[model samples]
Target: MFKYDLKKTLSEKVFIFWSMIFPLALMSCFYWAFGGIYDIENSIDTRSVGVIYESDNEFATYFGDVLEQIASEEDAILSVSEVTDKAELYGLLEQSKIDGVYLVKEDSIEVLMNPKYSATDSMILKAFGNFYVREYDMIEDAVTSGNIGAVATILDGMNEDADYMSKEEGIFAQAPNPYLWYFYSTLVMGILFQAMSGIYIVEQLQADLGVRKVAMRTSVSPVPKSRLIVSVYLSRLLVALGISAVTIILMNRLFKVPVGNRLPQLILLVVAANMFAISMGEMFGLFFKGSMSSRSGKGTGVIMASVFLSGEMIATLPGVFERYAPIVNDINPATVLNFALYRLVYYEDLTTFYIEIAKIVLVTVVFLVIATMKLRRQKYASL
Candidate 1:
């Protein structure tokens, strides 16, 4: 009987589609759209900069060689464009042809930039200017002190400081990438897809509205309804966990997502998240089962609603709720699960990780118990 139930459940087209193909297909689309972005973001090395000189000025002429040297290398810090006219330089800055403008002076170099177009490149240009000024001051000091030997040591120390500044912060805790939010949302959406199996389970019951020939047979059989429900739960649980595992593997290997060093913890969170999704789905399924209406449309709506609240649909939805109706984040299963996984894989905060895990487990237990009670209470006038 168990084998028959398992086979029938797995054989359903909807089951196969939702449990496996949909996730892979969606992930493929995600990979195609966003896979190259990380590399592109990381490869940016040179910012376009325009250097305008006062014609016939010896100081500007002297700085031309410095700018050329800085920009001439294969992997240069700045791609320099020498502008002879102030009007032309302003045009380039306005059109964003140059990230920033450098005005060469006899004693100091001035930077001109349009705040509207300037971004990180502007900051890079400013840092470069700061370094040049520091080096100039050091050279002047060394010349005045008549200590050419100490100049080398001071420059070496400055170089060391620059090297330290260039080094990235700890592997995971560095600057946050906005692109990762979409990937994180995709994973959560895929896991939430597991709810489809739960809806299918509910639809199979004789008490529900759908064609229930199997449910009728099971009703008359000696095997209890509670036992059948448990089997359905287990089967879907395993399937959901399997799908999540596959998703994680593809995300890391195919998409080249940096999952970091928390593989074991990530795996545990995946399983726990799947459990929460399955049980939550069952809770909704059983509720809608009692209503005996079409479960698919309603189930899909529930799933979308969960994702929306979790900020899968809108990135700021959760944040908005957090500020105003903060408890919604705590109550929303999808938000809780997504946050738990995010914390586990990205933040690696043990305290929040364990807290989120406990919340999921508690919610799963509550939903499963409610669903079991609903199933146990079923009474058929005629089967």
Candidate 2:
């Protein structure tokens, strides 16, 4: 029965088109449109600093030259521009064009920073301030080593083991994995929609198109319902898989966004999450049976639940609602999926990773079993 059903679905061109072609098309369009749009650029750190020191006085001349040298260096992250007067810096501050400003007077440096600026942005002011004071650190180190060429060797070593540097030294890597919070949110949403496609596919076959044919005995005898559903589900599964593959590829190629886990582990999690979503969708369709005639509103309910639980609204939703509401992020499948992915990447401990993956797989399996059972019990009249 299973083979016959499978063979029947394999022959259907539309199933292949929907499950593979259409989904690939959507994936391509989505990744292209939004791939570069999503990234973890600490543009906060890109904040430019205004230097209002004059280039005339001896101290000012030396300090200003040192500031430009540091800012121009590739390793130094800040962008600097000279300001003729304090009033100019103050005016730009009001406009918020730059994050902060500095006045390098003879006695001490005065920093005017926006209160709303992030800690890391403020670090630019502090770091450069120290560099302005300790301009001879590099010269001293070079002289102590008795070799000017040794600075390159020192820098090369720093680049290799930058993370292991002492607490005083900071490590700069690609902005932490951009996908940590919202990656799973997007993944879960995509999974749900893909599964819903299968549910609709089933309806198209039996409820909408097959209704009259099934009532006709001559037409009904040649076709088995199980074979039809399986065929459609297989097609939808391909589509679901295609969407996932394309997203991963786009993230890697375009954004260079790190997903943390090995490629294989990520694929496994994506497939597992998709399976659960497909199963839940199957149950919804089976329970409702016919959307055109039944008008059960179950499909609408599914979308509504997902919207609330997807974490997009979690911030606006009150704490009480988030805690107790069934559709809140804490209880939503999207949140759970994202949490698992985050742990897999961020948490170095394997035990926590395994626990989260197990939870998601458990939920998925339960949904799949229940959905299959529900569909098996459905009553379809002969055409």
Candidate 3:
């Protein structure tokens, strides 16, 4: 029975498209649009900066020393150049020989950049200047008030490389990749569409739904409805998982999307997600009053809405929901699956992953129990 059902499901062209081809096409489009941006974001090139001192004051000397110290670091992103002539520094910037220049006066510092300087480099330089100014203000205030202890404390903090925050062992090793969010959310959207198979299961087994003759024959067959439902579910689930595996392989190999190294956990997540999606479809099939195609259409609407809320379209929507309406994320199957996949790939939060799996299991059981009861009570007088 499972083999027969698997063959029948595989024969459905629409199912194949939604479960496989469409997602691949969408992912390819995303890669083409954002691949260059991702590369640029990850590549950090060192910038050459020139420093000119107008007066050898205490603040000017300290700021120059700080810049020298930063430039000396092995992985420094800035190369410091000291020039005595302001005209020479300006000439260098104008000719694109240097990215930016700093002017240190008696009590203030100024940053000058070429018009064509990289925006990222400009932002970094500005941030460094702002931080130095803030620290200088703190020291100035302490000295003016004759707070020797505060001045010493601030100086000690500036001199020491103290790490206030430590990274967890299993946290995302590199900077967060914004593009991965879209890809993973799209994958979850594909998994959610497997609910169509579940809907088809209901259409085949429900006596009064879908094709009357087929449903009638299936309902009255010698096979127990429980066995029939399980067989159909297993078959559809196998197909869904197979398609998902292919999608994941293509995403990693063809598109160069890294899905992380935790293969077992990833497999677990997709399996649970597939089951939850299919079971949700089963419930929709049983509760909604319509033909199979009508139910499938409604199911698609619901899935699309869930995917939208899960950040398939707007990457910030999930964060917004987390702040304002967290329950939406908790209950929405698509969001749950997406969160699980993301955390599994990027974080050591196994507790949250298991919790999401539990939710998927609980929902699947509820859907299956409700579907079973409804199908059991369904009787035909003259079918």
- On lDDT, the candidate that comes out on top is 3
C-alpha RMSD between model 3 and the true structure: 10.4
Cα lDDT of model 2 by residue, 141-194, tens digit: 676879767766655643442211121321111122222234444445556555
Q: In TM-score terms, which candidate is top?
A: 3
The candidate 1 region of ten consecutive residues with least summed lDDT is: 163-172
Query: Which pairs in model 2 have colliding backbones?
Result: 214-382, 214-383, 215-382, 215-383, 216-383
lDDT of every model, 2 decimals: 0.66, 0.54, 0.77
- TM-scores, all candidates, are 0.61, 0.50, 0.66
State candidate 3's TM-score.
0.66
- In angstroms, the error of model 2 at 383 is 6.1
Whichever of 2 and 3 has more TM-score, that candidate is 3
Q: Write the per-residue lDDT of candidate 3 for residues 178-228, one digit (tens) a residue.
A: 577678888888899999988888888877776656877877788888888
Rank order (by TM-score, best first): 3, 1, 2
Off by over 4 Å in 1: 36-176, 206-210, 289-293, 381-383
* Native-to-model Cα distance after best TM-score fit, residue 357 in candidate 3, in Å: 1.2
